[model samples]
Target: MLGSFRRRGCTCKKKRCTCGSMWYYRYDVTDPVTGKRKQKEAGGFATKPEAEEAAKNILAKLQNGTFIEEKDISFVAFTEQWKSIYEKSGKVKISTVDIRKAKLKIILKHFKEIKIKDITKLKYQEMLNSLFDKYAWKTICSVHETAGLIFRKAVELEVIATDITKGATVPKKQQTVEDLENGTEIPKYMEKEQLAKFLEIAQLFGNANDYPVFLTLAYTGLRGGELTALKWRDIDFKEQTISVTKTFYKKKEVKRTYILQPPKSKESKRIIDVDDKDKLVINTLRAHQAAQKVHDLKGDGNVFVNISQIKGQHLTTDDLSRRMKILLKLAELPSELTPHSLRHTHTSLCAEAGVSIDQIMQRLGHKDDQVTRNIYLHITKTRKKEASQKFADLMKSL
Candidate 1:
């Protein structure tokens, strides 16, 4: 139907069509699949311009093969249905679902009642910008992804004509010099020397559990959650490797504290090589664990445990972070470094030792080598500069 179609008043004898105040457009077309003749009408338009605008939109949808005359569905209804299907599909983690639901509130606040078909990339960008000030980039990205999924589902169901989030962007806060100087920049790993000093101090003065956890992370590059979720069976002393099959994810729900979950990604489920020094540390930690009777509760076969003061309970990542903060302070190291920095430190040290990028990616359980390469390149370049300065000093002495 074209916008130039003329509208006519209803000629019904009774009060069937009160078309005096309103104008409508009527047309007949054959259904493509069923070959059945169907009459479509665009009604309730108060004026010719309104009817023309509706006709233009309807005509555009028809020309583009997105003409769905179904009743417009509210965003709230569509999102609720999509969420139920997505959560029930078991493709995403429960923790992820919880986080996504929490982030979705930011979107629902603005677009709850609006029709799903009316949402556009501009609206999504507006929502993202509104959320940019209060939330982190990670949270904003999650919200964007969640909203995108809902929109995609709507399109698949033929509820909407187009996906509006295709060109939307989640703006990242720009890093400033003050952020860099104050150590408020992206989280980074420790240097090899700094790691060595920190680990030595941790061994001497840190709690019994901190040494093993730090050693495992520094040597294996396991994520903090993976480190905490390690089981005794995952270790193979003869093969000198640790199999990563699961992780301990912290749940933000009020009723739940944390849960043992699968690895973050398929690549995360890998076996990391263990060297002689790491094996020795592991053996010593095992001995300490047995002596301390840390795994007394159901003898749950987890490799790492809390200190004796905490009854050797399984340590949360948060607990490990707290221990790391204290260890860094005592070791006179930069307080900005967290437990995750150990993983970065491990990757950097491997690169400095001339390890191949492919091998580093496998060891770190990364799905792709691009991020690993970037980190390796940065660390190697810095090391090269340091080496050149050291050689200059050597020549000066000569």
Candidate 2:
């Protein structure tokens, strides 16, 4: 850190102009392009403490590839840059990165190629207001998050004087008559009938692992990552439960090649039962295990593998998604439903079958999941009405 007490300050914002009796600092970082050392400086700080703090942040961002020099950067361009840095940074989980990537795409549609320096809070909030009736509140919040991060970074890097996202309020979800009448407000998950039909379709049209995989997902409510990480040893036929100790973390997201990480929470590492009354999942699993021993298809490492064209490596959540799309297309079910939606589906169905909410949460390895609770409550409300009607009919008959 350097400070000039008598010397006139460079009084500059474009990197660091020298002569900061006002303090300034200089540092070296590797250039992203040339892969060689490059000098960088940030100045115009009024106090030594201020200069030191700015110096630390600027040096870190520059080293981490977050602060790149650009002129008149477009809003979309700034967002894309911010997203690139954000994803590369190790602060967030890989899934959050993917979510932010998608959210940014939605946000950019409104901002277009307008220069980032020109966007006002009024303008940014207008875009958010436009989204209120069109999207769910949760989805709009995600868009707000993506936009907020970009503008905040711009202020932090001194590209803009103020963050446009500050004090911006996202529009709340509005209810329509259709939402009330058709149960459209419920979160995405298969109904009991839709699930049964989807399972049958998978049995007939799915590839080798598809039937077992989807069935296991629906029956047991394991997260795609947790299920993908399971080994043959994780299953206990004697207890009729599957132990979920670790989850498969995608290697590109982490440093380790053998990327089995612990469960999402301590509660996530519990045993869940398998095999409903007609002995379906266990029988399917038994048959699946036998197929792994076949000479051509090596299926020994993980519980779920590529018995189809991909061959031996364990299946990824993305792979499961692609297969689900294909099966959903074949089955004529909702294309929007993801593998995780099946977790919600299991909660709803189990609730209807008289499984208590606590038991379902334990089985799904959730300490306290609002989504699961919502689905369970929705199912029980329906059951409550049915019971009320049944009592009314019995009284009328008497």
Candidate 3:
């Protein structure tokens, strides 16, 4: 309920309140938990129409769910509420939530005590600009996104009237000279030949564990996390299939830890077919685990572990990356290649084998075909030459 009245003293848009009368508005808002009405009133509008208009707006907001009394709330306090809603919504991955929280620290340093309504577009732009001197565009963009989300939430809750980030300019990252000169793009994967050579060298080392881990990654295109989270039960030897049901993600805040969660997406939960040789390698790994009495530490059924480590815990993504570097050295492969390159290698190999992009998406557990296609679409010098030659041959025949 909303009501307005003109105060007794005198004013009606007279421009000077020297005459005492002013318009006032009163509204009744229900206490959410208690079945009682709470009356809120505000006064001092120069005109009765202005008071009535304000009352109407408040009534509309109350009718809808967006009404909230946060005009005096500090930005940090509002951020806490926003974070709670974001986490409870479960719309983003935990890793993404962690990343956003970390990014918010930078924002809180500058705007912690400021009211959300007072942080204008210029202020936010200046904050982003300050970061540009010390950080890359991508990092600054992430901060911008976090700040924008908070502000947008505030607006949706009627805590603020507008999103200030709407007009802020975020620059794109500039390409380096080398990137432009050579038209060189990041390699999607280790080439098939390079992968074969690396795997061959890994096999020679004959470690019961590391060799099989690499083989599984290459054969199944499982993510580093998915590979680490695998259990013996997830693999079917007769069917030559590996079931991807769970995933591991790294968390690093106070301390580093690996957490097991569901696979990244529905498509990520899949069964990958493996060749007979790969199955043999898996069997050999199972035998080696038994020989080493790994069943004690692997009681939870984590497939990959650092046997060299005393704890014998599940392998972390960072540890896997470090090990890949060492393997690259032994295989005489590029130092830039990492375990994720194996997935890319699998996608590229599939593309070269004339497999359709949809099939490649399934094989790689990618929800979107564009993701599978984008990585393999890079045109190399050799491919460019082959295309030119084919075009020339067609011209000659004509």
lDDT leader: 2
Residue-by-residue lDDT tens digits, candidate 2, 273-328: 78578778888888887876552255456887765556777777878898999999
Q: After superposing candidate 1, which stretches have Cα over 4 Å from the reference?
A: 1-57, 60-66, 129-140, 169-186, 292-294, 308-312, 369-374, 382-398
TM-score, prediction 1 = 0.75
TM-score of each: 0.75, 0.59, 0.72
lDDT per residue (tens digit) for residues 156-239 in model 1: 888865677888888998888888787522348787788889988888998767777788788888899998788778887667
Worst lDDT run of 10 residues, candidate 2, spans 1-10
User: RMSD per prediction, one decimal?
Assistant: 7.4, 11.2, 7.5
For candidate 1, the 10 contiguous residues with the lowest summed lDDT are 1-10
**RMSD in angstroms between candidate 2 and the native structure over all alpha carbons:** 11.2
Cα RMSD for predicted model 3: 7.5
lDDT of each: 0.77, 0.78, 0.77
The whole-model C-alpha lDDT of candidate 1 against the native structure comes to 0.77
